[model samples]
Target: MTKEFLLECERKLAKSYVCTALGRDDDSIAITKEIAKDIAFEVTNSIHPISMETAPYVVAALRTLANGIEKEMNPLDKEIARALQELMGRFQFVKEEVKVDL
Candidate 1:
């Protein structure tokens, strides 16, 4: 039952992400990317140092999505992309602290 619950949750989250990406405004898109970065940070922080399973998947997805987005972005969206990149850079600094402590 718990596994089913988790699967359903993931499905719903995927749909939400798709909708958010398709949103009409730059703010909405930026918000969506920001939310994704937060989720990635949480997943990375929660994992044990020895367990390399989830972080690679999360990072790969982010890089792939970001590349796809950058290729198609208009000027307004370029600003949003810049903001997300800055945010991700800040997050990377925190991630470094975690790595150093490990």
Candidate 2:
């Protein structure tokens, strides 16, 4: 995907994150569905190279969207959250090695 396309997907996911936070499950579901393709796309840090920059934000958004859903199972919400959680794994988190000279 082009830079603009990935950016657009991130923007939409951010909106969905806010909607979910405000308990607007319906709206969140709609927005998530709109970018379901991007979410499902094979994105890896080695290939997509967004892990260091965009991955954290995307994972946080997905986490918020996944956690903010109501207890009762809304079929669509459940599926969206599931897919988002899966997508989160695709962005290989960057780990920094620390050195201590103590």
Full-model lDDT for every candidate: 0.61, 0.68
Which lDDT tens digits does candidate 1 get at residues 1-102?
256655654665576567666774565555456565655556555543533455687678768976897989899979966876676666543433223434
TM-score of 1: 0.35
> Which of the numbered candidates is closest to the native, going by highest TM-score?
2
Best by lDDT: 2
TM-score of each: 0.35, 0.39
- Candidate 2, residues 1-102, lDDT tens digits: the string is 578878999999999999999999999888876686454553432244344566578678756854775456688978766776675555544554334444
Worst-scoring 10-residue span by lDDT in model 2: 42-51
